[model samples]
Target: MEFSLPDDNNNLSLTRFESMLKTNNVLFFDSNEFENIIYHYLENGKISLAKKAIKLGLEQHPTSTNLRLFKTEILIIENKLEDADKLLENLHDLEPMNEEIYIQKANVLSKRDDHESAVQTLLIALDLAEVDEGIADLYALIGMEYLFLDQFENAQHYFKKCLEIDNEDYSALYNVIYCYDFLNDNQEAIVFLNDYLNGNPYCEVAWHQLGCQYVIVEDFDKALVAFDFAIISDDTFVGAYLEKGKVLEKKKRYNEAIDNYKITLALDDPTSFALLRIGKCHEKLGNDDLAVQNYYKTVHEDPLLDKGWIAITKFYNKKKNFQKALFYINKAINIDGDNVVYWKLYAQINHRLNFIEEAERGYKKALDLGNYELSTWLARADILIALGEYEASILNLIQTAEFYPETAEIEFRLAGLHFTLHESSKGHYHLKNALLLNTDYQYILEELFPNILKKPSVQQQILNAGKTEN
Candidate 1:
């Protein structure tokens, strides 16, 4: 499609137009130039030119259904959905058998959130013609829509219809898997995906989905095998590698998990999540140095990644390296100052350094931040006891008990405090509870509180207290 501009001598001819279009590739002077014009207008968003080109093309073939589709496409592209619908309506009247026009209208309505109208339009198109491949694809599309809306039954109906039309439709198969998974029908998803893969062994998506379903069902061994097949089928598949690494981690195969993560990073770029997993595997394997190094890689790759810094700080702090732990913990605080874990890590490092004042303030800060979890509060209780603020420790312990009545640690610690202060009755009461909950802890019974074990009167008190509490 080209437009003719006369030469200086006022002569217009095909040879000149062809030479011009060839030189510039604009095709400004061809009889069928409307197609090239519409394409250029669409690619560059030249709406005015697109309209003019549509008009020019209609002059050549006024009943051209393809040109009408082009107009509808341009309108849809410009988000003039109403205009597109109107144009599609005109085309439908001209050619009542154009199933594609109905589909286009359905698409426009679906985009506008009119699912009912979209479904009806497609249904009408299906009624008009049953054995169309396009209708099968439309069924899959409607299934996806219903899936997103959490109408699993409706979605399954459409997806099954698509599979009935074409048993090998991957989109329909995946949709069915998704719908089942959404409904927490992991067993159903497993059966379907397994059957689908048996028929289509080369379906990487089905294998990947089957592995994920296995994980959801807590069948890690089968998950590993599925992901193994998934990765074997496509070595560059990042999703399979990641899931395989997770299965390995669940199986406690830390080395294999790290290897999988390494390959995932090599295929993709180094991600903080992968690095964090690598660090965790090392940490579980008791390679503190490698864990620390990998954690550093994670945080270094994304300086603002909080978990990586947290993992690094905790690993170093647990290893009794206060300085290194402080470095990463402080880095984490700098990244997420409001995070309770970051402040808790800071307090831990300070405790290790015997910086009582700093540790106290750090713990107090964490408490101030509204994280009254038992672990943080218990640490506070211990710190208070160390500082000889026994009253504060007791109060903190009581607060912890309110949140976790089943826990024995809080009561046991409270008993130790009361015993230290020689409050015999209260001490006996708590100690009896500790023993009842866990009689196997002989060290607490013997070494930690020797007086209670030796004194007959105190033993009697413990028995009375246990009887009363029970």
Candidate 2:
């Protein structure tokens, strides 16, 4: 009833079955043909047609276990678990050695969240399974059951067992790595992968996994070597190239990283990640033209790539082109209006362009979207102060200080705000605390509070703090 369609020849069978159905001669199909027709419909997600096929198949072959099993599977899909269980139990009594019945029963138990019972049932299926045909699949199912139970070590053991049976089981191998990651046992993963590589030296996936583990442990040198081996094992491995680029980028080898990223472009279609990295490397190397070119290409390739827009906006901001930066950041916000980072960037650009009201509104939007950065709060406070809302600015700085209690800049700003509002005592108190936190922060007083710093009392207090620090 549930047969694997391993090759394109199954398409021919499906076509012929469709022809029969169109001619209204589906009744002529034998049990195997009818099962194939039912499976074809189910595989294509045509459940109604599959149900009709199953009914016709049962009418034609009244005692067919395969057709009955297919009906039970349909029942399970319909959430008729009780009926499915009863039918599977009857099938088990009729054919005690049939592995599919046990697998089906395990499926029912799994759906019911009885994973332990499911594992036991799968074990029974394993015991009766033919060695060459279904053993690997059984091992995989047991591994999944253990994963469902959050028993990562047991899952890893069974997945490893699957790999031993078929060395090409990439899914099982990846699951083993996932288990290691869940346990935070990268060293054990390294050791196991080293052993795996000893026997399977040319497996690109194993080498890639080994490289990832090395990266996790911050062993970039070993990671580079592993990624090199992955590329050597499969010359067209785009993942190896991309990961190698990342490690080289981490080491500040920008040119080498670009080379690896370029190799991925040659091996496959360009990805936003690779293009963005290449753009960043160019930006780091001071190749502004090339950086802008790649950034444009990145957004063109993926209009929704927020980072691409961000990179372009930051580039323009660095060049003191506030208008251009605002343009690109607005495009980014249009694509994803709720992104906190985009809103923050928009606020900063508006602040640079002297649009105080828009800047304040942008800052509020960013904070509402969960941007709690100290710099964001400080920028908003600056805007409030510029608007002569001293009390509102003080409230903003106080909220920021609550989050970053030890930051001298916030205290200095708060001191300046209190001085502006004629709260002399509070101003002196915050100034003393700011000097206690960072004595040299007085150097920014002219920039932050030029008018207040000119007062003799404030100047004398700063001078006194400087003498105390000395």
By lDDT, who's the top model here? 2
lDDT of each: 0.78, 0.90
lDDT of 1 by residue, 189-219 (tens): 8998888788778777788999999999999
In model 1, what lDDT does residue 123 have? Answer: 78
For this target, which candidate reaches the highest TM-score against the unseen true structure?
2
Error of 1 at 228 (Å): 2.6
Worst 10 residues of 2 by lDDT: 1-10
